[model samples]
Target: MDTLSALISHAEPKANLFFSGNLCGSSSSTDHPAGGILHLVRTGEMLLFEEYGLTHRITEPTLIIYPKGKAHRLQPQTLDGCDVVCANLTFKDSPLYRALPDAIVLPLNELDNLSDTINMLFIEAFTSRFAQVAIISTLLDLLLLLVLRHLVENRICQEGVLSALSDHKLSKAIEIIHKQIDYPWSIDELANKVGMSRARFAALFNQTIGQPPLSYVTEARLLLAKKLLLKGEPIKSVSLEVGYSGSVAFSRAFQRQFGITPRAWYLKQH
Candidate 1:
């Protein structure tokens, strides 16, 4: 059988599911599509963690997600039977999922634990025999949001500057920087704002996030600048808002990251 299998019971004119089926394998070979995986533990438990790496498990009465596309193991944790419902989803051109980090996990021991709306999606798909693609698509969106929310609430991120923002001191510091991208934020001052000694705060943040605090803020500001520029906002406006003195600095940063000038990107994007 293929790595992925989907069947919609209903075929409505306005499709409700993009694709639905089972995704299982003897092993997590590279054969699976490079996308997200949503899995529900139907019976026995599954231990899904990696050694000295990023991983989480799906015990009974649990819901687990593989957002970063990480390779992990799954099998019956008990003898009852390891039944699972798995979905391999891809949100091509969806900005929301694109903005998310690699992986997120949520726990659900009961079917009712999931959003009622989301559960209804499967119910309709399984019960109906028409085009349910529309419903499934929307349900998948909610699923993606919940997955990201899991990461956000837990503050576990495999990608994005949010990794740095996960720090309490740095999160606060980053908040201030975001609020005042126009203001020059010093690491010493930010540390003081968060009630940590400059040396201690900097060290802790660097150790936790693998980058200098100031660099983190700079990159975040540049990202904000890019967002604004993408919206066709004036370069000067973006620079001033993101803490740059003017368009020159912001444009330079944008160019450095995209290998294209902000204006060029804006024109092409628009």
Candidate 2:
């Protein structure tokens, strides 16, 4: 697993279809919750407005992703019409979620490699046959994955965890940490895994990821522990699951990381 794959695995993103239909001689505003939003245009044209100003003239088979869930307005350019499918993505908290931009627009030309997937989405949206919901749901999920791949391949994102994953050597180390959160890891061990000296690896990892290797590992472990705790796992089990030798040590670290005992945190969640 590379950094992108690890983050995606941890986030466990789910895409839910929100709306699919034609728009003509009308305008609509969509306010999305705190997640990602995707809009795929199958026909005609529309104008997207951000901050009450025209942002992009969405024509052709285009896909737009608002990774931060920024609210925007969309209106058909003419009475001739526009056909679109929109979906909302809910993701568990992860650095990849924060790495995405406010919005990304990929037109037909840019989505040439995904022509088949795009065509299928349009077909499913219009057919309205049996199991259409299930089919569309799967296609939307596929589309989101493709979008993430495209973003990384095109180097469109320049900051946050995604940017760090762009580095080949650093990505390898990140993958190891994510896959083996229960392992007793140290800066020297991580450095050796990536074939770098401790000092050099520390410098490069810090420079690229904005944190030291050990610090990143600690954060990753705590994140996994929190997720397990939220799932109603026992405190002792969660502690060992995240590499702590005992609950007392884990509790102290957890308090330092989150300012509350694991049991208290779990109670609040309930």
Alpha-carbon runs more than 4 Å astray in model 2: 25-34
Top lDDT model: 2
- TM-scores for every predicted model: 0.58, 0.89
lDDT of 2 by residue, 84-133 (tens): 88888877666677567888988878877788988998899988699999
Worst 10 residues of 2 by lDDT: 25-34
lDDT of 1 by residue, 161-237 (tens): 34544556656765665556567889888888889999998887777656777876666666556666656788888
Residue 46 of model 1 has an lDDT of 58
Clashing pairs in 2: none
- Give the worst 10-residue stretch by lDDT in candidate 1: 2-11
Q: Model 1 — TM-score against the truth?
A: 0.58
